[model samples]
Target chain A: MPNDTLLETRPVPGTDKTTAVAVRTHALSKEFGGRLVLHSLDFRVEPGELVAVVGKSGCGKSTLLRLICGLEKPSSGWVEVGGERLSGLSRHARLMFQDAALLPWKSVKANVVLAAPRNGRRDRAAEDALEHVGLRDRAHEWPSILSGGQRQRVALARALASDADLLLFDEPLGALDALTRLEMQALIERLWLERRFSAILVTHDVEEAVALADRILLMDGGRVTFETVVALERPRDRASAEFTSLKEAILERILGRRS
Target chain B: MATESLSYRSRLINLAGPWLVPLGLLIAWQIFSGSGLIPRRILPSPLEVMQAGFHLTLTGEMPMHLWESFQRAIVGLMIGGSIGFVFGLLNGLVGPANVLFDSSLQMLRNIPHLAMIPLVILWFGIGEPAKLFLIEIGVFFPMYVNTIHGIRSTDPKLIEMGRIYGLSPWQLLITVVLPSALPSVLVGLRYALGIMWVTLIVAETIACTNGIGYMTMNAREFLQTDIVLVGILLYALLGKLADTITRALEAWLLRWNPAYR
Candidate 1:
């Protein structure tokens, strides 16, 4: 399927110095009530890499994210983050969900602060994170008053405020409209570029994976079935031939075509 | 500008609507009683009720009854509400607690609290303890049921998020679980307030020598129906005041809730 030949050889800008591995999963598997949801799989994410996992519904993408984030225990096998084995939720990693999940009782800034570690400069860090997501003015407003897009932005700010070394996105932009999705994609790209934190985004949208990731993995029947790397440059042109071809290649793998 | 004026006029009418009927009834009673169609002994006029209320207030008799009743209600509410809250939290969060206490409490809840009065009196006698016991029993069930429901019905997604964010168990209760359960808890509190007055009235009428209930009972013996009416009015006013205060508290605490806004 030309999978080995498709690995992008392009050097990631501003990330050459760090040889640190951010995440490593060895033969991970999960089952619920005797039915297997995630098959034994080996995976690794290098520091500052943005990896995308794409698959259809019920294909174990979300389960993989949950396991990596320590929200779910593996039925067997182990996960290592920042070179240490994870027991429960890893302090080095943060997760963003599709639902935003901001505490409705708290103000936007307080929601961000809730994820931040206690310190003298905690509020300053939260404010900076909110400013990064362009939500500085909305810091004191309740989550209920925010629009769906704005709420997601606040959720992004919350992840940023956490200051975790790795970020997991579980279809965080799946609920946005077309225009908002594009805006969020750009914002996510900008933030990932600036912070250089390792990120793994699990999404159903093939074009989004091409637009945002350094590499993309396709999962099916509870295992990674296809892998490809995006060779395009940052601020990638969606209308460019490379972008379309890359998206087409991922789509073919997802659709079960051996191209 | 015209629409603004129209809305203003409608707002005024809305504000005045509730009072109009009561005012009309008062005026009609005064006119009819002044004409002497009905004997004053059978039904004292509204003026007589007001005068009795005013005279009682000036003599400090009404204040004494009111103060005694208020103290009892507050003490009972504080004791019963606190116990209910703690039990609810325990049962809702811990599986063993739920298994041990929930069913027993539910079974006990089904029995009418008023039905326990004679037993309560026998156990505690016709003193302050008996009256307090009745009020406590009356208020406890609603608070307990509501707190359990509130804690149990908290959104699982939010709790999951709290775990992911590394919130401690206490933080989770304070931030997510408690706030989510607040509306239901407030509803329970309002319900308990109504029951408190009802229970107190029954307890006082049966035996007490103080409180508005005792005053009403005393007036009934001498056929001082005006004073009796005044006592009833005082109960209605107190109940309304409690409801208003509870509503205001609910609004302030739940200001972040979109449904309230």
Candidate 2:
């Protein structure tokens, strides 16, 4: 069994401490009451990979992210993060919601600090994370006073402050205007590149998937129906032929399924 | 120079705006009483009420009654408020506690606390305990209802986020749950302060040796209508003071809330 091998290559300390953790699900399924939201489907994300799951609303994309983060349990089958099974909330993963979901009572910096591990260095870590999102100057301000994009940036900073190996994003830019969405996409891409954390981004926007993910999974009827490898270079040019074709292909599939 | 004077006049109007209505009413009151249109016994003029207040203050009687009333209010609030808070925290956060106690408390809350005066007197025999009991009961329900409502109304998404972020149960309560519930809790506190004075007024008037209510009763028996007016005005002033303090508290604690800002 590769179980022994899984133990040996477990991102040993003093050797690539920033090495991202792998996520795997074995025939994972989730049922709410008597209704099944996610079918018995298998999925995986390689260490340091940026994978996007695109689908129509209510196709269980958000459910999958919640399950992976261990916020909700699978009704059947199981999930493994970095080789071990996810029993409760995942210790190595951070999930960001569509809404900024900030505590209105806390300042931006305090919200980020609240997520950082209780090492004595939490303040420093919060500052650094805020710096990464270019919100360091606004750290002392309340989340209420921030613009939607700025609030999302603070949320991103909060996730980064935790230093988790896996990041789960559920339509993080779904509410932003087009210009803000494009800026957030670039910001997310840059952060993913810098941190190299394993990310599973569930989005409805095909162009967003093309601009960010290394690979894309098309989900429908509570199952991943198709997969596409972008094989495109970083800082993807949306006007380029390869980028346009890939985006169009995925968009057509989603539209075709809808019809 | 013209612009500066205009700005100065606007600033003066801003300062005087809130006092305009009360000042007009006071003038009307004084003129009507001076013209003898209404007997002084029926409605004492503002000047007579002020003079009575001054005389009582010089004799140290007003301060003594004021202190008694103030002490009762604060003590009742602290004791009742703390118990209500504990019960609320327990019922709101713990399922079994809610199942066991919530219905009973809700039923008790429906019974008008002031209406229990006869029963309270029988239980505690017209002592400080009886008055305190009434005030405590009056303040308790607001605190209890609001604390639980505040806690129950906490956004579930934030709780989920807190759990994912590795917050311990206690940390979640302090950092996420409590802070979110605070605005509601303060609203409850403001309501409770108003209730505190009301309960004390009724309880003291019904049966008590000391306090503002007793002073008013004593003035009525002696046919000192001006002193009676003074007592009524004192209660109004105290109520206003309590509201102002609570408003300041809310402003300071909810400073991050844009509405408060």
Candidates in order, interface RMSD in Å:
1.1, 0.7
Which residue pairs show backbone clashes in model 1? none
lDDT of 2 by residue, B1-261 (tens): 999999999999999999999999999999998678889989888888889999999999999999999999999999988888889899999999999999999999999998898999899999999988988899899999999999999999999999999999999999999998899889889889989999989988987889999999999999999999989999999999999999999999999998997
User: Taking the tens digit of each residue's C-alpha lDDT, what string does model 2 give over A57-94?
Assistant: 98999999999999998999999999999999999999
**The best candidate in terms of lDDT:** 2
Best by TM-score: 2
After superposition, the stretches of candidate 1 with alpha carbons farther than 4 Å from their true spots are A1-21, A257-259, B38-42
Which docking band does candidate 2 fall into? medium
**Alpha-carbon runs more than 4 Å astray in model 2:** A1-17, B1-14
Every prediction: chain A TM-score: 0.90, 0.93
Cα lDDT computed for each candidate against the true fold: 0.89, 0.92
Lowest lDDT sum, 10 consecutive residues, model 1 chain A, at A11-20
Residues A61-111 of candidate 1: C-alpha lDDT, one tens digit per residue = 999989998999999999999999989988777788899998898999999
